[model samples]
Target: MNALMLLVQKLSCDVEEHVFSEVSLAIEKPESYFEKFKERLDERGIDSPIDQLAWISLVDALLDHDLAFELDWKESGLYICDVVDELLDRKKMAYISWGDFEDEEFDELPTSQCLNEISGKLKEVGISLAYLDIDSDSYVLITVPSSDIDDIKKMAQEAGYSIQDSF
Candidate 1:
């Protein structure tokens, strides 16, 4: 069983994008992570609809918040699966999805089908969908050159998806 599966069992729900972001943020900046995440949610105007219970559950899973905060993720064994270099020969990447944008959800189609469509569109625009991980239903992670970010964003927008920087 992978870490994701363990987390899913712990949370008792499907792991969503926000869950991953919050966990990543918490691991990266334990002391101020929650505050920063709340600020970010406010900036995106998503704070209002936040599920407080879910947030609490996530925090509870941290186990002894104060003590946990003092430890580094690597020391604490918080495994973050990073496959960018393995899949795309890149050190940096971003996650793309139909993230709450007022666009048609790709839920009707299988993830592979949607990815194929997105890949075809990207290829048509001379962009390579080189690195991709669609393991989660809510998003796809891909490696994009910094120079090509704008181009990829535009292409994703045209394809009814939104792009977000990976945490």
Candidate 2:
């Protein structure tokens, strides 16, 4: 119900017939995620206009489940990809999410390997892991969820990464 969601919904509708509306309505049926998201945003005191828009983009992506990777990529076991080409601004780090996995899977090495691959790509663009959150039956905010920054950096460096921007 936020302005950015409205804009995205309107844009999606304009370009793709009824696709956006149907998706939006479906997502709204279970309102817990949206409600918690609003609370998280409020707690962060995110008053900036750009941050607001980013939040909207995040929500829209979540609603659509439009982030499934190709068979080739999924088989490679990675869960994210560079979306820099799709970014409106070069300075902003853009990434496309892959399909969701259960929260328990996140703590495993294979999962981190997948995430690390994506993080490796992002680091090439001077971006590090900002954070990742999951909102399904349980709403959670995972800030620096990884066990060690050194480990992440080592993995990234092994993947031919550059200096990541300070978050």
Candidate 3:
């Protein structure tokens, strides 16, 4: 699982070039970590296989957002929580998902106002704000850098919720 570990490490370390390069290489080489059918279709300029592009785009977005962190992620690992995940757990996060809302309807939602409201609410609970997606009506994810897990759990319990480990 070195490849998977490498991907996770790159993500945890916030190694931009290395991560992008690995993903690009994975796209090109068709490793066990990634499916190749989509890659092949991509190279042919066919539009049917979109998951490859979507996954790549998602990784790009994650890396873009990670640039905001002041600390080194490689040393930190994934022990720190992503801000969007926090908001989602609070039920204060919103996102456009087929399971919930459609893309067009989600686009019509008041995102800025919603983000502000969620931010304020999370702040009250001693949680920090991270990322919010208005167009998709989704919150990215957030985590306390050095906060106690017990305390965070307490806060979530107080809100009549529970926290789950994220992948």
Best by lDDT: 3
What is the lDDT, from 0 to 100, of the residue 20 in candidate 2?
46
lDDT of 2 by residue, 109-155 (tens): 34335555545555554444433222222111111213343443444
Task: Find the number of clashing residue pairs for candidate 2.
Answer: 0
Q: Estimate the lDDT of model 3.
A: 0.38
lDDT of 1 by residue, 22-96 (tens): 654554555456565565445434443343323332433332221011112121110111222222323222343
Model 2 has an lDDT value of 0.35
What is the Cα root-mean-square deviation between model 2 and the actual structure?
14.4
Candidate 3 stretches greater than 4 Å from native: 1-109, 132-167
Error of 3 at 113 (Å): 1.3
How well does candidate 1 score on lDDT at residue 1? 35
Cα lDDT for residue 144, candidate 3: 38
